[model samples]
Target: MNRRGFLIGLAAVPVITGAGVSVAASRYTPDYEPLLARLLALQGKTLQSSGSWNPSQIFQHLAQSVQGSLEGFPEHKAAWFSHTVGPLALQVFKAAGAMQHPLDQPIPGMAALDPALSVDYALGHLVATLQNFNEATGLQPHFAYGNLSKADYLAAHQLHIEQHLSQISVVA
Candidate 1:
């Protein structure tokens, strides 16, 4: 192959590989069952965090988000923002089947997290929160995105967890 052809072929590799990964990731729906299973598998494991928050903090943060979906968010973006930019952002993330956001930022208006909380406690809260979310028939409005259907919330939660999980490394 000529240099141009070879370069074009090489460029396709990542695109193809990424498409395959996205398909596989989407196959496992990000809902309570799969999330619970993942959490259970990690029970009692030691983990190191690559992000600002430790594993415990991550778990608590996730739990808080899940809980917030059921009970209304403590704070919300302006209606115009939620109606415009927020929903657009959510749709983009949903289309990609992934979410990206600042990791260090906390939910607006929520109380400060207790950094000293044990991983086990945090995990328990996460699991329980997921379960509660699954059983809930009605959902409250999201802080930024405003209103979301049950399916949308599940996907968002899954993407959020997946993003956070990327920062976690099991400590041997």
Candidate 2:
């Protein structure tokens, strides 16, 4: 999609500010504006994760999901699940404007995140992934959500990020 088309597709996206299950400030947002802004705010901050993974891992995981939409995911849940439960799950999450999932779970076939991954690199990768997603055409099927319209996929990405970002906190 071209810039104009992407923007047009996003014209009606609802703002998801503070729509999350986490106490983390970066709340839910289907649109990129607030999520990207939150990332920018984290650029120089000291971040700690309350979850099993570190902040870098969380960022990398989020990047992988977004990247998956553009390139394709390596594995997928059973088709029945993607065709049935997956769409239902996306709808439920969208209705609440938040997502809930096991934070420690890695994407089905992806390797474990490197413990030594740099926060800066992972964070930058996520930023770039989101940017690339904006103009992405022919998005690949989601690992679980199956195929989705660009708008729905964007919502999925943002909600997924919202949930993970909740695990991270900035040091004072």
Model 2 over residues 1-172: C-alpha lDDT tens digits? 8999988667635324223322232243477788789888888778999999999999999888998899899999999999978977787787777889999899988767976988988899899999899878889999999999898898998888989999999999
Please give, for residues 1-172, the per-residue lDDT of candidate 1 as tens digits: 9999999999999778656655554464556677779888888999889989999899989988999999989899999998877866766676677889998789998878788999889988898899899899999999998898888789889889888988988888
C-alpha lDDT of residue 159 in model 1? 84
Off by over 4 Å in 2: 1-29
Error of 2 at 153 (Å): 0.7
Clashes by residue pair, model 1? none
Residue 129, model 1, lDDT: 91
TM-score against truth, every candidate: 0.81, 0.81
Q: Rate the local accuracy (lDDT) of all candidates.
A: 0.85, 0.84
